[model samples]
Target: MKRQQPAQIKGLKKWLDPVYSAWTSIATHKLRSSLTILGIVIGIAAVIALMSIGRGAQAQILSRIQGLGADLLGIRPGMTMAGGIRGGFGSASTLTLEDAEAIKEQVPYIAALAPTFSSYQQLVAGNQNMNAQVIGTAPEYMFLYNLEIADGDFFTDYDYQRGSRVAVLGANVKQTLFGDEPPVGQQMRIGGNIVRVVGVLKAKGAVWASPDDAVIIPLTAMQQMVTQPRTSRGERVVTSIALKVTDQNQIEFVTQQITDLLRSRHRLAPGADNDFNITSVQSTVEALKEATGTMTLFLSAVAAISLLVGGIGVMNIMLVSVLERTREIGILKALGARERDIWGQFLTESAFLTLTGGIIGVVVGCGVSVLLSRFKVMTTLLSADIIVLAVVVSLGVGLFFGFYPAWNASRLDPIEALRYE
Candidate 1:
């Protein structure tokens, strides 16, 4: 082992010579190297920026879906046909509190359920006023929608049954209406009627229905006190019913059960379309995931085309470098440099150039993402793994594109190279 050590050291030193030589060659051409590196830098930065938008959108969408609860289902009044033009979803209010009560009483495998009623109106508190969505729901609405009380308490069953004029303020609503003062027990006017604030909800960022900007009240209070009954749906109306299943596996079966029960109760003909729509939050999430993921990949592909362009720049510059260094290659070959050594030297230079650019590109991409996020254009994210991946891809791109130039140099005849210029 001791006798073999010196031979191993000699071999290692011989291998390292090409690496240092390649780096020296790259360092000597600062202007040319910088321009080549800039191409890769722009390509990588574009990739990071575009990918972040897709990923950020995906994250926000998933959060909103999760806020609805994992096993939650929404049963909304379906479209309405008027004057031969079909109105869109939520255009009708065929759902009722009785329907919710019936589902509560009859449905099994249900973990939670609530009646949803809502209208958008400007709420007034003293001299302050802000337009917000007024939501009328049951006691379960807080837990069902993943809400947490920041101050007082949510309306109880007694409040709903007695049709009490009590309200729960959302974070933004509280800020706009009450400012820094304690909001609990304060009176606020909705639809011109004074209602006492009972609780304030913790900050929940932009949700699907903009619930963070809503004032929550009891269903009975909303029905009896403030708003008039809609001429089309009349009294005893609800916008939708939200339910949570006891088990994830039982979701489809329970949804089917609810569907059949609703049809049977409504006494619909076999072929008649139901006036309501049932939607699973999980299904919505999966569908959104697929859509956003596909869009991300497509945009990423478009951005990645820039990387190929950058690679071509690397190849072009490397070919020029080879042409300029023909006499140097001949001198090295005459001094006992092998074809593989010449190949390795150029390949190493290419890898170093792209790798350095990749590191700088990551920083530039992150900076661009932060700026974009500041402007609220879209969101971006960076992970350690993504950074590492960009570097690996950059190095691979450099190696693949730099190969032909290196090979051409390695195959040149020593006599011909030495005689040139």
Candidate 2:
């Protein structure tokens, strides 16, 4: 005669009652619940922070390497063995200005080339003197190295041909010598030899090599004033050559052609080792990428250990929780609650605890990452995928570790649990 609620509806309400009570009970023991969640929070935070740093570092490295120019190729003097002994393993003096000219004339795919020699010397401007690297290079070196002229202009072919003692200051060198004042047309002493400052380079942030710590001068001036001429031994000479290729795809072909040409010119016998090394920008980039990946994996592994520890902590706490709430389980069983309902209730409580901790950990981790990036300690990129993964992992931990305790509680004898005190 009277309207009756469906049995399923009544059962659903009864099932949810234990979950609600468990949450409230946990709230009553705030300190214990907080302590239990601390491990998970720290673990998640560590994972997030470490992953972000790794990604940021990789990005920074790749960007710097790419900035060197995609078409760049570097040639360095290679080791050579002679008379059954290592004779000229040092830098080869055979790579002269003539080699640079030969490469340009012979290699059709080569867009530009620069032969460079470097030495460290004291640079004096008025009363200010500081030790800085002096690089002897042609004007094309600027474009090959992606250097921009901030003021004035790079040395012309006339400067190289006439052996002008003109110099260009890198951004840092300019600032250190002249401060905010214009440096062009100023006379500076490099290794006690007077040289005119013809240009100031734009500021390029520090990379694998600091671009700001050097002064650029004509290669002829470096040879005449800075480096002592070799008498008999051909060991002292230009260190490297930079080549800009016309096509990225032709890098290997160009490298092989150059090697063959140099080997022939050097008169090395067939099957004998050549005395030069050629490196490409792509190879450098690949090496950097691989190193970054290794670093990221190592850091992530270390952080994962913490997550594993957190999972074990969750399991231990859930077991303790089941033991402590034995009386509650018995009362619920006595009140006609089903075993499945008891299982769900305990499982839900564990999940809620972990999920709450995970959310908090994500926020804290992101905040820490942002702060670190702002301070230039490392870069942090928080992606949507990482956030989703953190939450999923946290929920999974709860499910995996909470199951045993939940099942044990659900299977307890009501009479025995009721008398468990």
Candidate 3:
């Protein structure tokens, strides 16, 4: 066994020698190698950065929607058709307080309801004046939006009954109208009517039309001040109604019940188009997630085109390397080096080039992600899977494009190669 140790050592040296030589060849041509890897670095970095932003946006959207309560559902007036033109959501005031009341009274699966009316109006608080979204909703508006009173109290049911000119300020509204001073108890003029401030809401951050930038008042007061439509049933017209389900599992059942109830109330015949639409938190979230996922995939595909180009660049450089080292390959074959050894050496060089560039690209992408978020440009999320993908893709590119050049070197006729050189 001791005598055979020398042969084993020789075999190991033979295997390692080619890898070491490949490393040496790449190191000696630092400038050429660097330039060749630049395309790959750029491609991989772009893919990661764009994907990180997509992932972060998706998470934020899901979190915001989830925070609104999974059991929550929103009911808005259906599309309005006037002549040939089609109006968008809430264009017609078909929903009324009577509808909200009926749902609350008849729907056993419902936990709560907040009938709401909204319009954009200019608000004046002493010297500060700004245009803001004014919402007329029930006292449960804060609960529906997951908002808390930072100071004072929300307007009471008695205030709504009397159509009192009282209001609750959103975080942004408070900051804009009151500055550093207390907003509660201060009077603000909205739609030319002076409404007393009853409370200020806690910061909930900004999402799609977030309540953080809105002003809340009683539904009755809103109709009285904002000129909302009045129904023949002597009930106030509302733009939408928010409902809370007793159980998340009962969402579909409750939705069908609501549809039946509303269609009957609207006097629509069987199979007739309804005048209202009910949207659930879960369905909305799933739709948004699907859209975001598709967008991310499309953008990532665009970015990957650059990697394809980079692979072509790798092939070009490897071919050049083979030509430049023709005599070296010939000398190795003359010294009894096998064709497999030649192939392994060339393949190793190509792999080393990609692996190094891939590592650098990852660092670059992460740095760009950090910078974008630091400047508040946009959000970015980097996951372990993304990093692994970049490395694996780079290695795959090396193997795919490097094969032809490596094979060409391995198949060279040593006598012809030496004679030509």
- What TM-score, over all chains together, does every model reach? 0.76, 0.78, 0.83
Candidate 2 whole-model C-alpha lDDT, 0 to 1: 0.84
Candidate 1 lDDT tens digits, 163-242 = 89999998999999889999898899997778999999998875575566889999888877555345343446688899
Model 3 spans > 4 angstroms off: 1-21, 61-66, 121-131, 175-181, 186-194, 231-235, 287-306, 328-345, 371-378
Q: All candidates' lDDT scores? A: 0.85, 0.84, 0.87
Each model's backbone clash number: 0, 1, 0
The model with the greater TM-score, 2 or 3, is 3
What's the distance in Å from true for residue 113, model 2? 1.0
C-alpha lDDT of candidate 3 relative to the true structure: 0.87
Clash pairs detected, candidate 1: none
User: Ranking by lDDT, best first?
Assistant: 3, 1, 2
Error of 1 at 93 (Å): 3.6
lDDT of 2 by residue, 199-295 (tens): 9988888576556889999898888896544424453467778999989999999999999888886777999877888888799889888998798
lDDT of 1 at 206: 53
- TM-score ranking of the models: 3, 2, 1
Cα TM-score of candidate 3: 0.83
Best by lDDT: 3
- Point out where model 2 deviates above 4 Å: 1-31, 79-94, 176-181, 226-237, 267-274, 292-306, 327-348, 374-378, 403-419
